[model samples]
Target: MHEINWLPFWLTIKLASITTFLLLLIGILLSYYLAYNRHKINTIIEALLSLPLVLPPTVLGFYLLILFNKQGLIGTLWYKIFNKQLVFHFEGLVVASVIYSLPMMVHPLTAGFRSVPKNLIEASFTLGKSRLETLIRVILPNMKASILTGIVLSFAHTVGEFGVAVMVGGNIEGETRVVSIAIYSAVESMDYKTAHIYALILFFMSFLTLLALYFLNKKWKPYDKA
Candidate 1:
């Protein structure tokens, strides 16, 4: 048995978890905006959010690299605030992962928000509930499948990220060397055994996560059905 340094795997999971959590929070408001409000500018906003789905990872990562550099807008502001550079750091990976995985969370959540009935929302308002209360007490509870789908997809997508992670985080050990980067490093060193282990773990883990999602949705929908 080749002794595996599990730090990369641990780091990858941590990144994915953090990204998914942040996306969930952001997606709730963003998805609500996209789903309920129709305006010319909303189209532009959604397009920007969805760009990562079509943009090449290296292209997106390159731009993010520049943006996260110490001289870049976000990076400069961050450096002055915390005295830390975002590039080639774990923080960089989180930011990159969030951007790269945005559509995965947002699209599903937007769909879920739209799936909610308009009357139900209005009724909540008529009953004197605020929008926030309706969202919390009504809409979200009804869209369990969409929420789970977004969470799983974002988490899975973040796990498999390679180009963005490499470009932004630079494969630093224990800090930014996620499983995908670790697999590439292992293969490059002719360490096929290590690479195979990581690959198989990812494959099975992703597969199982998806499988559980579908199963839960299938069983959940009938119960959640109005």
Candidate 2:
């Protein structure tokens, strides 16, 4: 048997961890904002955010390329201001993955936030809690399962993300090359054994994450009902 490259595996975990953490914060904030607002801009932003779900990864990556190219608007501004290039790097990968997996994170968070009872929100306000306090103490506490679900979903989605990462991050070893990209390279080289190994790891990790979610939700069933 060929020896496994633990580097890609560890890098995948790190990328997923960072991406999931940022996505969790952004997803929860977006969900909360969407839940409380009925504005037309919210609808438009929500539609745009969810657009990644239906769009092909290659297409999305192409647009990101244009958007982050040295001559591109955002890229030029970033470089002029901070002397940084945005493409073919870890930062670019994170941006791509976050955009790609946003819907998976946002959908679950929105569902969870919406599930918070109106009575609890009202009660918190009646008890003289501010809006921010009510969200932190009342709504978020009630939707803990959903929040956890969103985090797990975001992390898993990001770990398995390939096309966007490859197109934008360019498979730089020990930098932007995640497990998914490693698996792809293995297959490209006709290394089925190594590919299988990486694929199996991803499959097992995803399965276990979902299994934990299932049991966690079941354990929280009574609280959900109450």
TM per candidate = 0.97, 0.94
For candidate 2, write residues 75-116 as lDDT tens digits: 788788878787887877888888999998999889888888
Query: In model 2, what are the clashing residue pairs, if there are any?
Result: none
Q: How big is the positional error of residue 184 in model 2, measured in Å on the Cα after superposition?
A: 0.9
TM-score, model 1 to reference:
0.97
Q: Compared to the true structure, candidate 2 yields what TM-score? A: 0.94
Q: Which ten residues in a row have the lowest lDDT in candidate 2?
A: 217-226
Clashing pairs in 1: none
**Candidate 2 global lDDT:** 0.87
Model 1 has an lDDT value of 0.94
lDDT of 2 at 173: 89
The top-ranked prediction according to lDDT is: 1
Clashes of each: 0, 0
